[model samples]
Target: MAISFNQAFAGHDKMLEFRSERASVLANNIANADTPNYKARDISFDSMFNNEQSKLRLASDNDRHIQGNSTMGESSGLLYRNPSQPSLDGNTVDMQREQAEYAQNSMQFDTSFMFLDRKISGLKKALTGN
Candidate 1:
């Protein structure tokens, strides 16, 4: 019997991709901190989840299997962050806030990596019967 790995991985794969893309966006914001009129951009996971919820599901091929809902290649929302205080040069990137966000994003990326690692390990254990 053929087992689709997609059935086992679930949404975590997508979540990890989203997190990675978000890291780049956050990094871009930090890199352009000094550029005038450069607006900081961020991704919203909640919005991405909500958008995924409306996707159409396909029928299962057999009675023993469930339909897979894994959709790949999602581009982030990339919305501009509104600055709490406007800078004299119109740059929207806040150094302190950007730093905090970068740190948080890094933590989240590590978390997602750990979760994926644990999941793969569990799958390995199951297949190996160890």
Candidate 2:
């Protein structure tokens, strides 16, 4: 029987990737905060997760067939944030809001990292009989 790491790690690996991508987007927004007409972009987790969930239907030609492994889909695209107050220069990046979002995203990324770490640790222990 072949075991796929995708099945073992579940969605943690994909979640980490998504989080990293979001961090980059957020950092870019912060970097261009002063640039005129720079629109702040972000990922919507609901959109990605919903896309993943939609692919999880069970279908089998035989009763003994194994179920398909469902993995999280890649991000469709970045979503633009509507500014609370439009700047005269047309820059949409809000430093305070961007900073808060960055911090929150960092925490979520850390959480996914910790979850994957614990899963790997547990698997190692199981294999080593520790």
Candidate 3:
């Protein structure tokens, strides 16, 4: 059976999705920086990626592994709590830090999108012998 495009790029797609979600979380943190008692939220990409990889490795080791079901383990992607110095009002959201993180995440998101687009374009070319 031929692997579908989604299956082939499942890992990349999940990474992109997580990055996008993380960007949203950072943006929200920045937006709420002025709100009293607002805590900043940030995703731990290393932990998330490692967890996903472990899950995939475990799933692959199963005797009756299913193809499309491998991607179902991506639900562990979520923002982690920050342990940095908090504001006097108990707001952990630092506008400058959040803005920097948001900008970095945006760049990562765009890069991932571009990579996926290029991969898809390459696949199209291969399929069409262009």
Q: What is each predicted model's overall lDDT from 0 to 1?
A: 0.81, 0.87, 0.75
TM-score of each prediction: 0.77, 0.78, 0.72
Candidate 1 lDDT over residue span 1-130, tens digit each? 7756787776678878988888888889989999998988888897566556636576787978876675652544567898999999999999899899889988988888888888899999988999
Task: Give the candidate order by descending TM-score.
Answer: 2, 1, 3
Name the best candidate (by lDDT).
Answer: 2
Expressed as tens digits, the lDDT of each residue in 1-130 for candidate 3 is 6758777675678769888778778878878877888877777778677657657533356668765445543666555467477778888876777777788888888888888888888878878999
Residues forming the 10-long window of minimal summed lDDT in candidate 1: 68-77
Better of 1 and 2 by lDDT: 2
Which of the two, 1 or 3, has more TM-score?
A: 1
- Which 10 consecutive residues of model 2 have the lowest summed lDDT? 69-78
Error of 1 at 42 (Å): 0.7
Q: Looking at candidate 2, what is the lDDT of residue 55?
A: 75
Listed per model in order, the count of residue pairs whose N, CA or C atoms clash below 3 Å is: 0, 0, 0
